[model samples]
Target: MTSRRSFIKATTLASAGLLIRPSALLPVSSRYIGLQLYTVRDAMQQNAAGTLQRVAGLGYNAVEGATYTGTQQFYGMNAKAFAALLKQQGLVMPSSHYRLGAEKMKGADVKGTMLHGWDKAVDDAATVGIQYMVCAFLSPQERGNPDHYKQLAADFNKAGETCKKAGIQFCYHNHDFEFQQQNGQYPYDILLHDTDAGLVKMEMDIYWVTRAGMDPVKLMNEHRGRFPLWHVKDMDSTPERKFTEVGSGTINFKNIFKHAQEAGLKYFFVEEDKCPGDPFASIAKSIGYIKKNLV
Candidate 1:
């Protein structure tokens, strides 16, 4: 059915590596799968390079870093070196986790944290091909005070400005604790309402939101486009309500994924803080189900 002119155009596009396949034309969230390296933390600690190879072999197109150490190295490699390794495996690092320096060691000079050397961290993130730099967690000492949350919102806005200047979006990653009431208002709400939506976006951890008894779809509908990053994991059906592989759990991911466009999702990383048996096998199951059904 191809005309000669159309055929030539197609040939030229393909030759120039610009040919858009059906899958390529599909929504990015539907086609791409990324892993949060924390899922295989042990393996990564043991052998970062080999673990990345095995992960790429499992068909992940991207990855998110968990441990940006006090030394400002990802895993054990500097930003440029780590980025090179990811490129070698045909993988991209779209996002990486950073901290607010709430847990810094005693008398230690830590660089590349939210509270210290943040600009340097943002610069390093840019070098590593990261589009998003996330405030990964809040230590217990940092929570329980409404004043602290308000201060955090202010701090996040400042950090967001720094990231914006560097061409990166700053995001906050949540756990269930954010949903808990603080002075009759949720800290998460404070963070969401106080920050500039353009600068400080949210990285919604679907599992945590669900665990907090909130609907991910509803939240996305409420704050459309504010959430661009997601942590994709599942909850077991058991009473314990623990982490399980993607399709093996009770989350309606097929339905959630249908709303990806509304969520403004650019990238999602599969993360399981705790996995029984081999973590690689667990990720394999998660990505397999995602490719087959969810995405």
Candidate 2:
């Protein structure tokens, strides 16, 4: 575990060069501490109910999901049943991750993904009490010319409409790839510029932003209210920059979290894409540190 003194030191140092306004120093506005279920993918695959119980036991009141099965089920349960299961554990899933389905699919053979059966996906999300539905990742084959992102922006706007009708916010989650320059333009910037802010919000992954050598606070300041959900994952200090427990890493979450209001952050989830050991134990350490500090 990273000690309180070390955490504060990291925060101060990271905040040193930036101009910190009084408002920026205020604590994060929302108190709904959340976890991304993908962090415990193996455990979830084995036993979702038990995994969620452990998550709630670790003091997480909320969760963000990453898996939506081909059968349109969540962890092997139907939308309503999954929602009920979450309620049983006193957990509310405010956000979930979905993908862009096959670019070309046979009639009525599509799964509930952004590109194919979005309406159904949104409907199921609503059933699960999910307020945010995020396009989780872009597969390698999906990546093409810069025009693709523009088309994606259009698709996102369309998807956002469906989600809006269902009272769900549609967002896109980012990885470091989005930040890389493509034909002298960052795809991420294109997404931000082309999309309707009200329609297509963002689920900013802090670790990836930092991994790409970008400042999360700066992005927030540049595009206010564009981000409503955040993946509060962390990067280690070493050159390899592996995923680590929240406070145990080099990322200065304290400073970044203080600017939550600027980011339009409503709910933030702690996520470690790959953990060093027992995933539950990793999250337990993360939540403990967050409760004592970040949240």
Candidate 3:
């Protein structure tokens, strides 16, 4: 009984609406806020279950884990158990840090045999519903020379290939060390240029980049869509430049977040490696500020 013209108009409007991204319709503040468990490492080491419960109560809906591989357990709980715990707390672990073992450094051809226990690590990570497996740090021995970094980049590609098989991503988390120049070139540049974009991605730690006197926004512009994860920490305005709660420090998070699309940011985890007092108190303050100001 509807008029033909009215029906056509409705169809056209519906088709137009379909072209808009669903995320564009939501408020920016509606995005999920994740906490890196390392921020509460001490408490988590003492009582992971209790600490995670407190984290949930503090309003964090997602978490990034720091303990895996070495422990073969997530904060003392096996993969399945930990996944269940997360569901109970209304939290999801989108990413977790896993150190690249010595065996993994042997190169792609020998990755499977050299890297002992990596298969289990990947399997466990997938079981826990992790989307990204991050190479958290490079030990002094692993990063001694320029050649070492090149090898590391190859290893990262191999690791990424492994993660891809499991339906997960592989990423590298940086510290200021990578920015240090060796013979005129930065190791970070070597890694970025050498790795396969499809196989490996980056998890930029804004605090570390700032500490290295580099610009995060510029990096995002240079490597569009390569970074999907971020470590959201802040630096104090003091000359010494110490760690501070998010938004409480001098870092312009609002400005950095404005380039989220360019950085391929899907999630960011708040981290505070050093805290003056109770870690919980620090995280609470940081999250409160983020919600009110930066999102």
Candidate 4:
């Protein structure tokens, strides 16, 4: 009553020079834009915990993993050891990629994929504290006909339903193979149309999608809300189509970010299976570009 507007102005000024409360600050870029550890798997192997620390030092607050190389477990350490290290570095793992070739589901002596030591794959996902379980790559054996993808879609539905019980989702990550036509339709079209919308969501690797000769943004629109995650890598300018760090590549990240919501995108992970020089330096550059330009 004495002067409400003046009092509010004075309060704002009092706090202007002071650090705003943590909750009051806006988030930096998309905090969910994480790195898939496979980008720097070799470094992690050299020193498990320290590698994660380096990734964190570069400003990544989250990670999506390639999971296990040799005996180096996902995140480059055992569950307990890795979890401790992640906490120290303020990192969270919202998702991970796992090989899902038919061999993984149908093994000889091992029963199933070595990574998933069970009769079922869904159970293995819950044990890891991840909400998203992705089918990373498919062997050529898994492709060929519409029936193959149909069956794969059906299996995905069943597995997705299995994960639902534990509050999880089953997703498929695509390479160029899915873009090939089967019968009259693209294999990806069949998979999308055949799979239960709720069961088989997509993890669109933008670079691969682009490499497959499709528009990433259009795919996001056509299958609205189907893509919950993305593998954020860039393609070199050369005709050979080599991989490069973000921004340095030809992908239009700024235009793509406009459709983030419709894509149902919850996380974006940097994954470069091969690199020229120090992978960490490349990732650092990618992070800097994301924060400075793409953010």
Compare the candidates by TM-score and give the number of the best one.
Answer: 1
Model 2 C-alpha lDDT per residue in residues 1-295, reported as the tens digit of each score: 1243234323432332222344754346444789999999999999999999989988898899888835788999888788779888988787899888754445454488887667667767766777788989888867767999999899889988877776668999999999999999999999999999999999999999999989999999999888888998778888899999999988899998888888888888999999998988889999889888875
Per-residue lDDT of candidate 4, residues 1-295 (tens digit):
2133234323432332322344642322364559988888877768767888888888998888677423335554555455556667777766777664455333532222323332243343344455677878777865768887888878778767665665567788999989988778888998899999997899999999999999999998999989988888899999989999998889998889778777877778988878889999889888888888766
Q: For candidate 1, what is the lDDT?
A: 0.84
For candidate 1, give the lDDT of residue 11: 43
Query: Model 1, 42-119: lDDT tens per residue?
Result: 999999999999999999988999988487889888877887788788777778999887566886756778888886
lDDT of each: 0.84, 0.82, 0.82, 0.72
**Model 2 C-alpha RMSD to native:** 10.9
Error of 1 at 6 (Å): 39
lDDT of 3 by residue, 57-115 (tens): 99898899998765688888988798778877878788999887773444622221215
Please, what is the TM-score per model?
0.90, 0.88, 0.87, 0.83
The reply for model 4, stretches above 4 Å from the true place, is 1-29, 68-78, 104-124
Cα misplacement distance, residue 293 of candidate 3 (Å): 1.4
Candidate 3 deviant stretches above 4 angstroms: 1-29, 103-114
Q: How many clashing pairs per prediction, in order?
A: 0, 0, 0, 0
Clashing residue pairs in candidate 3 are none
Give candidate 1 misplaced runs (Cα > 4 Å): 1-28, 107-109
Native-to-model Cα distance after best TM-score fit, residue 224 in candidate 4, in Å: 0.8
